[model samples]
Target: MSSNRRIGIIDIGSNSIRLVIYEINSLQAYRVIGEFKQSARLSQRINSDNTLSREDIQSIVAILKQFQRICTANQVEEIRAAATAAIRNAANSQQIISELQEYSGIRVELLSGEDEARIGFLGMIHSLDIPDGILIDIGGGSTEVSLFRQRKLVRSVSFPFGAVNTTRRFSADGDFSEEKLLSIRQMVREAIGGERWITEHPGLPMIGLGGTIRSLCKINQKKHKYSLPLTHNYPMSAEDMAELMSWLPSLPAEKRKKVDGLSKDRFDIIVPGLTILDTLFKESGCSHYVISGAGLRDGLFQEAYLTDNSAIGMSMPERSARNMLALHSCSPMAHLEQVASSALTLFDALQQTHGYDARARQCLHIAALLYRIGVSMTYYQFSKHSFYMIAHSRLDGLTHRETVLCAAIASYKAKSRVQQLYAQFKDVLLETDIDVIVKLGSLLQLAIAMDSSETQVLPVRSAAVTLDKELDITVQTQNDPSIEYKEIAALNKDFKKIWGLKLTLLDASSFSTN
Candidate 1:
């Protein structure tokens, strides 16, 4: 098998049909290369007899044909297509599948409610490292709620009604009066009330998937003028949801369309979607709401193509750092590994003086691995470029604040530069974080200087703090070690300023002689 493969996944959702192309490397790390989405609102086309209209099925086939061509053009090695509630709940699902296959030459996998819920759970667990939480996926035709403890799926249930269908039933005219809103909430409460497990686990964070939840996250971020724009693990609260629900209905239809971060296509259906989320939030007694960028499509890809499942449930920051290193770094893996090792050695040696925790240590390690990532773009002022990339890229499993800290550490050049960068994101950071960033960044700089040659010649044999309050790092090297020594000498002033300790480097022979 080739070391690299490109796979295409088509998700036939009730509200939309999407094709996402992912390029997978040898290590099983994958990134989305291309995506296309067309809104078909298949649920709205369902007949009174619980069958999708033939016209909609034909439209589905046409979209599949186009997706197939795009996949072929992208040299996609394989395509995995799955149909969720819209087609699965149809009375003539078999006939619809046959026509779609016969026309588009694409085999469609009809996911049962259980399958959809489980797959979505898989996506959530792998993407976020939440140990215990309730997972809610609001789709166009159905909503899947799952509870997991210790990173394993405990129970899952799929509700029959979702955003599109619910809207068609209650607010088809797009005017939500007090009575209509009450009816919508009551129906959602009754549907969720049947599941006793939902209320059993109270105060657990609710991890949300699907388009509706993402829209809510985006709008909140925009409303608050949030510093970080990425949405994978964005967090809100029950109060936040209630605030949006209360505020949105007051806006006239025309005004709602003008709200920033809300897509023009979602104007009519957003209210029903928010209603579903609001009901779930209140029913589950969740304290926090976290948005997941991955959903059924990511779940499908992981189940079908990912060769290494070990990354699942691993330390999220570490996993995210390694993935970024594999996908973006221009340096050799050995060099990056050596830098990380040296930085950690220094961190552990000076832990007593710094009094930092494992979180800061993890940030330092990630920064060491990714500090050179910006070299992929341009070597000129690469540190600034590295800072921008790390700050903005989807470093999954990291809170927005932690992500900024990592970026600050990776691109550390001077205290003034870091303070300037921190100014832009002070809303998300603490005043004390500047002290942490500078200290960790100084350690990273010293580590980089130790590997200035990128030949892995100066591996730290031991690092310690002497009685005189000076940091002494001993290295084992076969070469002359002069290059590393000269580089370390240049950083001594900045290192002392940040660490409050004079710096010293001793070769193995010199240490043994002493």
Candidate 2:
């Protein structure tokens, strides 16, 4: 399998068309290289007879042609294009696809409502660590709701109405009378009422996809001055969503655009979109709404390009951490793995003293694996670069607090430097986290020193806290480990200060004989 491959995914949605190019690395870890989107509003172009107009068909072809050219220029090896809702529901769907293929030289895969729901579920499952939830994606002309348990798709349904056509139907006069709101709410409730599975799963987190959900998350983030700028895994309570929906209708059409975090292009359709979300929230009695940045396009990319499922059993944080290592680290995998193993050994051995939980252990492990990722940029102050990269990259399955802590642990040069970094993200972190970071940071530093030679020869044979408030570690080494001893000696001051234990090193053979 090729280690580096570029694939392009073009999504023909009813409200917009988008093309995203991804660079997939050897480990099947991917990142977006280029993204382009244009709002065509194809749903509004459908005639009363359920067929798209010839002019609209030409418009679709034109957009695809441009996307094809962009893909060609990027040297994309494979291009996967799919159409949903608008083209799939149209009576002349086959004709539209034929013309698009003939003119654009890209075969369009018209995804069915069920297929869209399933693919969206695939994207969500791979990106998020949530074991069970309700997935909702609201496009321009259709809405897909799927229920999953244990990360497997259970039931999915697609509603024929979406933000675009719903707005056209009820708010055509540009007036949201109380009657119109009621009608819209009633219609949404009635549409989803038939799906008993949605109502049965009360209090499960509702994972949302599509533009409307993203916009909602942004608006909330801006409103509260959220500390983290990330949108994925952003959580909003049902009450918060209800509050936003309630306030949105009060604003005049022109005034709504002035609100922060809302895109100018989505101004007209946002209200209807929110209404659909609000309806889903109330109907399902969900505990909270989490935004999923990955959706159908990501799902398509994963299905077509990613073949490695070896990381399936790993936790989300570990899997994502490994991916980051694969993508960015210039160090040998064996060296990194050794460092991580030593860190974990020390963590487990010292459990009786620090008493940190598994979460802290996870952070320590991830930090150990990625501490050297910054070497790819520059060796000088690489820890700082590593801190910047790990803190910024979507380390995927980690919470905001965990991600920050991992960065702090990886970049640990001194207690002072870690403290300075913690000050910046205090909003997401607890004051006590400083202690966790320092302890784990020291452990990581010690772990790196054990493998400073990068030969994985000196392994921690055993570690234990003695009665005199001293940590004694035995290393298994055939040859003299004077360099490793020297590195470990340097950390004694900070380690004792943070852990309240004097550090002692013992050779495995010497300790057994004694």
Candidate 3:
């Protein structure tokens, strides 16, 4: 519940140990300040009898101690450590957990298969605006599948089909032959066959989480020379996935290291990971899938945040937007609120003239919250900075399309830079969408100009739209608002160009100020 403190989350899985440190602004407003991971691979060294080898225990202890030093150096205030399937399935898990606690001074909570699936689902639902579909998390020791409709977790199941285990069990020695690949596919099918919910929700997009899925996107992007470097919400087609799977199995671990985006250490396990993903795609009939960068650590953060904050069930977008603003801005929250309020007021009053609907209004609201974000970088050309930040930043609860629109609208506040920046994203946007962004940007410019002091205490009494497509804006003071009026007059030509509207300032001294 403290502000500006660092909280660390540790995830000990079958293949790796990872720690994520987050800087908190409030209970729900935080950002990842640091992260570290090491491939301990305790699952790979587990004896056939299901007991951890002594060498495995020593390696894990060393990794945990290294993680502790990082946490201590970063002044981590609290830590929540969890161990997943590898430790859960081990016969000596209890003794290992005890040794970890006694020697490392960190408590280890073991997560069940169902709990793991739920946590992955939690991370995905809050990170993506996905309302329905099958969520798949391919881990080292298990694969978790969860079904959600409407933003809530519905049903989840975990299976023993994992990348590390399958690799050691079936494809350890050489390239995957046709017969071996077929056996692996059959195994996955048998593990996931009877889930009627997967068939019931036909055509819903698949959202994938975990390191393997992200690595696949990275490799594909590198091969295709994709312009964007972002991995979150990166779209991949089933055909594209199949193409990569076909070629990847043939590349030995040494050759795989030569690939542009594939990490050297992940070479041995990637084949089995891709094989499982390919099978899942075929079984679910999902045409394409989106990658989620957040997973179990993010879920733990959100759960911990909600327990301390009053905003437990708020819509993810609004909460995420506010958190983003809080993390980036030193400006007064009141100012941002006023700008958003004024922009929405203008949007509602001009709906008949502009003919744009609620979605446009939502974009306007987001742009208002972020328009000045670039000021943190440099006051000069701040709107351009805001545009770049919104485009590049991982804003939760917004789709790729919405992120693009928001960035366009925010950039237009700079006025002179609008056309240049708008042209850069032409491929991703339609002409009509660009037109709407311009219209909304015009309204936002007017709203921002009205609060001349950058203070929420503007003496605006009321605003009215007349039938002749004119806006009569009334301010409470009679001491001429020369600056405000001039700002509106400066944009008059463009405003009329977009909305066919005339603007006039009404004298509030002739009537009640309130």
Candidate 4:
């Protein structure tokens, strides 16, 4: 509950209006606290003259009022609401915006197609560490495709064709035909082909946003019975998608509603959505797609928190790790920092001894920071609890394997053996990886013991590792420092077994002369 403030963001899209409330502790620390979504399909209700129908306007007002009430109940400090494609293209957009503002006491900013594409792209980049990839946001009224390389947004293009619009254009009466499907595919192909940049990068995977993509992912998860329920970075292959696309259209609308991942409300629009994805897969030559649950709502939240574009293209796994610690652990942050600092230094100095890469150092640092998080639950076998928490927690910018490795290391530092953890999580981690965790965990154990004095004011004079794998460490202290040395010496057996090295601790206090 220790956080800065709770704010609400409402994204009024052509297909749905969604409200997400975020509890923000800092620029790096924020999590979704409340969410409500209603499928409006406003774009399908627009009249031929390009004006929002009165029925759609009334429905929008009702949904906004409900959102306002929820925000009030949650005591949200501020609200950021924006309307996309449908509102932007409507001739009576200003009038409807004013009326909705008066009714709900919330101003709705209309976002242009380009703005929608950019914001959706921003949201995907900040949450997922895809160094280079294409972003696809299939909305109710429009589809925004953006390209990024090396974490920077390079190009963006918005096609004025989306699920709801395409559905209405081709098949609106619950009728299905191959001709209709082909026409939808043709439209998507033409629209995407106009943006030649999508094909410029051949093998980069595509990250997908919007309701349709999430629904498809959910269905896939239900079909596969995947262990993890998270959808943020769920990956789906083109072949599997092609199967879903081929099978979904054959079902009756009512049967589609009963499908595991397909929502009842979206049954009618799903065909077009999948068709668009199929064409995109062909045009981009990408075999897999990652589903991103965060979209414009998260973009609005980040924009408000950062107050600038600083969070746009940067990858902040370290920051995300710190924030995850801040949210879960009840231990003091200073203690965590001390352990992490010492762990990283020890890993760096003993690299030649351990022969692990930079990634191993990252695992050690994260483990040290989260080593005591399990104490929040109980002191008894806290390492086991820590493992469960890390495996389940939202630690971004790390792969599933890295997350398991970090959890395993934390378990080792908590007194569980690396072999035991490897046996438990063998499906996700390798035996060699387990060896690396044990080595890093041994180093972390020494670091934590060095700071067991609790003050962390003791200076480490120097640390050295010889080519023959002998590690000599000297610390400055006024006292004999016997307790610290004894604590570190306890791990000497494992250290020697794993790294083929002898660790010797020395105190400079006894040798110094004034």
Task: State the C-alpha lDDT per candidate.
Answer: 0.87, 0.87, 0.80, 0.80
1-514: candidate 4 lDDT, tens digit per residue: 4556889999999898999998866544667888899988888888999898766788899999999899989888889999998888889999889888987788888888888988887787777878888889999999998888898989998888889988888886655688988888888778767778788788889899998899999998889776555677778888879889889889877788899877888988988888898788788888589888777888887777655443445345566677777667567777778778877777878766668877767777778888888877898988888888887776677666788888878778533567776676665577788668877777888788777765664456677887767777676665555566576768777777767878766667656421
TM-score of each: 0.97, 0.95, 0.92, 0.89
Error of 2 at 322 (Å): 1.9
Clash counts for the predictions, in order: 0, 0, 0, 1
Q: Which portions of model 3 miss their true places by more than 4 Å?
A: 1-3, 26-28, 194-196, 308-314, 413-419, 457-467, 474-480, 507-514
Candidate that beats the other on lDDT, 1 or 3, i.e. the better one: 1
In candidate 2, stretches whose alpha carbon ends up further than 4 angstroms from where it belongs are 1-3, 173-175, 478-480, 509-514
Candidate 2's residue-wise lDDT over 178-203, tens digit each? 67788889988888779887899898
Could you tell me the lDDT of residue 256 within candidate 2?
A: 81
Model 4: lowest-lDDT 10 consecutive positions: 308-317
Q: Evaluate model 3: give its lDDT.
A: 0.80
| Residue-wise C-alpha lDDT for candidate 1, range 37-130, written one tens digit per residue | 9998998999999997778889999999999999989999899999999899889999999899998999999999999999998877777868
The candidate that achieves the highest TM-score relative to the unseen native structure: 1
TM-score of 2: 0.95
Extract clashing residue pairs from model 2.
none
TM-score of 1: 0.97
